[model samples]
Target: MIVRCLEIIHPDGDYPVAEFDGIRVGGVYPVLEMVTDDDHCYIRVLGPDSPDPGLEWDPVSFETVDTRIPPGWTLAIAGGRTRLADARWQRPGFWTDYYRGDPQARADYDHVKSELLAAAPPREN
Candidate 1:
């Protein structure tokens, strides 16, 4: 299944509508649009077992893992794969662009998911 993305409005606002495969699967963001705001928020996509027929807003859960790039590699947005190459990291801000850097592949949803998964500080084990 293709992992789609949607914009997450904040300050308690409605999430933009999302569409995939011409199917109006329930979502809280738009398929393609400029996202504004810098609240360290998230852009979520529903899973297969999403609560359909109901839009009950609820906090999502995730897993965590100790991970980070080698300070030079970049993330593959389309596939969530990382490759060692010269990459320019962008500053924290409202990111409207789907991908990072020139010749952008796609937005780094995997990276975002990773961050969310590890939102809690990692424990040395």
Candidate 2:
């Protein structure tokens, strides 16, 4: 699906983002991936300064921090794939490296996220 959104700064919409299943996405935060099935959408979010350990998304709200990374939080809303790709590419650093598809980025992010998830509290289900 095409990632379209009215920017608050500039209401006119822009590029489409990609999802976890490999579609496009767009948002304030760089969306590494997204999952939209049924009426719900789940996105793998990354932060600017931190690893952005995963979150337990209940399809509506996020209550669990799956990764060891603290100060982690989920933005419940999402947009089309790669919607922010162009804008993101223009400015890069930290977790944004992964969003740009840097080969080592996935490994580096996975390593950190995995360790955090392991150390994190167990999930309810």
Candidate 3:
């Protein structure tokens, strides 16, 4: 499975770092290959089942990381069907890459992580 890096510029200047299974891609919010050159930074409302199961079709906005490759910067991007826009999973805190484990998967669904978690059914005491 190919994992794409999502370039997100947090409005508060806190960028979403690129991570796969909790492994940093050398830098915070690094450019990923799965992101096509044609892709531009904008907010898109994803549909239901777009990200994962149990996630309702609630509109989630995101900033696409449009990176211009530097003259001497070389990076490896794992290829997969995943995209920045598709990053919005059906459930908050749900990761598309299940193989990576819970922490990593949840890390991928950063956009609505808080929302999803909050939306989740309260734990039983």
Candidate 4:
């Protein structure tokens, strides 16, 4: 089952999207996404979920985390095997482009994906 990303759209009018590894959220900030067995998700801030400079915590939403978080948002994943903090998830389907940095591997993967797509049956409604 394909789950959806918890797209955090701020009510501050800007509606800035955020990530775990973001400067104001992750990395030095360490605002990590914690997922539960019932498919519930929340944050487990390590030290401080530092709110971004010039941005005040929206009333009735701010948590103890230091980083400026958009209330609660989905951390999209299946089985939680992979991670949202990883850069790879940020650029979906860009693996080919990334491996293009290693010419031989890129060519191999592209050919494989093409062959697989060609062989796979078409989806039906």
**Maximum-lDDT candidate:** 2
- Model 3, span 8-115: residue lDDT tens: 333445656443222223322222222233433222222222243222111122223333432222332234323343333423334436445666565655534344
lDDT of 4 at 104: 49
The ten-residue window of minimal lDDT in model 3 covers: 53-62
Indicate the residue-level lDDT of 30 in model 2: 32
The residue-by-residue lDDT of candidate 1 on 16-102, one tens digit each, is 444332223332221111112333322232332333211222222112132333333343332232222214323332134433332
Q: How should the candidates be ordered by lDDT, best one leading?
A: 2, 4, 3, 1
Q: What are the clashing pairs of model 4?
A: 6-74, 48-66, 49-65, 49-66, 49-67, 50-66, 50-67
At residue 2, what lDDT does model 1 achieve? 19
Whose lDDT is higher: candidate 1's or candidate 2's? 2
Tens-place lDDT digits, model 4, residues 72-96: 2235455543333322222344345
Local distance difference test scores for all models: 0.29, 0.36, 0.32, 0.33
Q: Candidate 1 local accuracy as lDDT?
A: 0.29
Give candidate 2's TM-score.
0.30
Top candidate by TM-score: 2
Once model 1 is optimally superposed onto the true structure by TM-score, how far is the C-alpha of residue 10 displaced, in angstroms?
Answer: 17
Of the pair 1 and 3, which is ahead by lDDT? 3
Which clashing pairs does model 1 show?
none
Model 2, residue 30: C-alpha shift (Å): 18
- The C-alpha local distance difference test score for the whole of candidate 2 amounts to 0.36
lDDT tens digits by residue: candidate 2, 20-116: 2211123223333344545555645443332344321222322223322232322232333222222222233535777777766667666645543
